[model samples]
Every structure is written in structure tokens, then in C-alpha cells.
Target: MLGKTVKVVAKPRRGTRGAVSPRAARMVLAGAVLAGAVAGCGDEPIKMGAAAVVGDDRITTAKVDRAVLDCEKQFKADQVANQVRTALENQRQQQPTSGEPADCSARSAIDTMLNIEVAAAAAKAAGVSVSESQVDRMIGLMSQQAPAESIVVALGMPKQFTRDVARMNATQGLILQRLGADGNAQSPATLQAQQQALALFRQTAGKLDIKINPRFGSFDANRMTVTPITTRLSATESGVR
Candidate 1:
């Protein structure tokens, strides 16, 4: 999510594992300040080791590497050429632009993973649940729209990561279902539940003490997504619904 930045970022480069290298992390101006600046609402920042730490869970660099390899398996350079262009164009329109996008990269895949992890954590906190069967059913429904792998790639995620993300989405849906929000586009109950879920998400984020590698980016509280800390951004409290 694009939001206010304390400083604008310079151009971006792709990291081998779908993030900027630590060396590049150092190159980015104001890297140290942004590292743990927005890790928690007021709690102590998480110490970096793996890619990030969400609550008691650790999202490791090894997982990220596996995802990078999965993304490579999903599509070839020519297949996603136009889509990559469009994605970059979208990133280009950011308010305090976070620099250029990688030409032939799976970097954005990491963002999808980060968002899913945060959303899953929040959903668990909100008492949202989806059985494995429910997840499978949702997967079937979504696959009817397109191949599962293709859909994941379309969302800038690794094909191998689809099942978990699908489960997360299903859990989010369960929240709406519990509120009787499903099939009621403009229901007050739906809106209230959505609001409540967001609140829970923010609360969870506050206590999660998430620490992302400065290489990939800093978390944008407003959008609940990671933004490259190429600049000194003014991050605020936020969550992913």
C-alpha cells in the first residue's frame, strides 16, 4: 500500500531471493531508522534474524527462497512480460514513489506472502476459522476461474503458496459469514464485522512485533503491506483485512 513517506526512495533493484540484498539495504538512505520504526504500535521492535517474525511465528529466509523458486516455476519471462510491465506501472504511480520495479523478477511475490501471513494472524485472532475441507472447496471454486498456479501468479505470488493463501482467504470469508455478511453487499452487519476484524488485525499487529528484513522493505502500517525503505517513510498504525 502506498502511503506517506518521510523520504522518497531511489531506484529499486531485484534481490536474488525476492528482496533487496542486505548490501542494497544499507545503500538505501535512512535504512536504520526505518528498520524497526514501525514494528509495533508501541511495543519493543522485533529483532531481525529470519525474514520476519510474526507473533510467535517466524517467517524464515528459507521459506522465501522456496517461494522464489516456485515463482520461477510458475511463469517464464515472456509469459508474464506484459503483466510485469503493468505491475511496475502500478508501482510507479505511488504517492512518494518507491522507485522502479524489477524487470524480470519475483520480488513482489514476497509482498503477497507478507500480506497473507499478517492477514492469517489477524484472522486467527478474530476467531475466524475455515476447515481444511472449506479451504479445499474454496480452492475448487477459485480454480474454476483459472488454474490455481496462474491465479497465484496473477496475484504476484508463488504457485506453491496458493493453498495457504487460499486457506487465509477462506478464513477471512468465514468472518463475514459469521456476521451474516455473505451475499449481503451493503448489510450493516457486514460493515460492522469488517470494521471489527480490521480492529483486531491492528491490535494483533501491535503485539506481533513484526520485524521485516530491511532488504525487502519496511511495513506500511496504513496498507499492512511492506514498502521498500528506500526512503524515510512516516509509517503509522495499520493492518491487513
Candidate 2:
């Protein structure tokens, strides 16, 4: 059984117009890419100590742990330095008192990496690509709202993976553009386009072999998120027939 589930969606802040802000749009697109049940069983076994496997690539447990630690450290430092509070103030948003759970951080790291892989695959299939310059430009635009490091921490991402986050966002943006989002998130046409893009990503994700280690939790393909697995007693352990 699944325990606590960590779903990562960029909640809209105050003063944002449309159904989704640009930042929120990026997160939503990545998070909602695959909407269905858990990933189907695959023939190839998951590598030992892997956090998750996407096709030929392996997201190692060590990598996840390091990311989580880095995020926590950076967040703590930000709190001490008042960077988070200042950023929230600049953005006219209320501040959060506590950091997210360790499990959630791990899930986030896994999900972000998985989303990047899926986005790349989707782009390749669609004959679309986001250039490095485009990613840099997107990061620059994001930095206009707040410092990149602060934004990274605010998004629950590690500072080290800043470029990865921006690249994923840029790729999704290009995909949505190709799907005719038109920069009007609140418009029906844009919403329809987003839906179409999401469906395309879902199809792309289905064709890839994805697996999550049970220790971290199962991958919920429906939500494109990770859900914690609850330990269950066997029939003999429970004294049942």
C-alpha cells in the first residue's frame, strides 16, 4: 500500500494572472506529463541501489541523497541569511515556516530527473529541441523575479541542479509553444494545447522503461509523482491462514 504521496506542483503566488503563471506552468507541465496508473512492470531488473531507472539511465540512491542534503543545506543557509524571506517579500508572497520532509525532497529529486528524461524523449519524438541558449535565456528570465539560487530553494530544488531545472522548464515551454499555448494560460485554446501536450508526454513516458525502488516508494504514473510504500505484514506474520 502507498503511504504518504508527494506531488510537486508549482502553486501560483499572488499577483499572477492566468490559469497558470510561467513558473507554475513549467512545474505543472512536468508534473502532469504522465497521467495514469503506476508504471508497468518491465523485463529488465532495476539496478542495485538505484533510486529510479528511466530507460537506459539510472538515478542512483547516492545521487538522490546528495541532492536532498544539498537542498537542505542551502535552504538552511538561506533561512539563516534571510534570503527566502526576502525573496518571498519581493514576490509579495507569504513565507513558509518549515522545510519539506526528507522523503518529499527525495521524491522531488527523482521526479525532476525523470521529468527531464521524459521531456527530452518527448522533444526528440516531436522533432523539437530546446537549445542551451534557450535554457540560459529562460534562467535569466526566471532570475528577474528573484535570485536564481533563492528561486531554486523556493522550488525545493538543489542549487547544483539549477540548470537541469531550467532546461526542463525551457523544454516544456518549447513543447507547449509548439502545441500552441500562445502565452495565454487562462485562454481555452492554451488550456487545450496544454492538455494535448500533456497527452503527448504521457505517450512518450509510456514507451520508456521507468521503475522506482520500493524503498523510496512506487512511482505513480497517474500523477507523475512518488508515493510512499507502507510496510505490510505477511499472512504468516499476521497469524492468518
On lDDT, the candidate that comes out on top is: 2
What TM-score quantifies how close candidate 1 is to the native fold?
0.62
Q: Residues 17-42, candidate 1: write the lDDT tens digits.
A: 23222222212211111112224322
Candidate 1: regions farther than 4 A off: 1-49, 77-107, 231-241
**Candidate 1 CA-lDDT value:** 0.49
**Prediction-by-prediction clash tally:** 4, 1
Q: What local lDDT does model 2 show for residue 203?
A: 76
**Model 1: number of clashes?**
4
lDDT tens digits, residue span 1-241, model 2: 0011222223335543222234432332232233223233243446676877877778898888888888878877553113333333333333232222222277767766777778788888777888899978867765653455555665556777777767766777787778777777677777887777767777787788787766666655554457665548442443321
Give per-residue lDDT, candidate 2, residue 56: 76
User: Highest TM-score: which candidate?
Assistant: 2
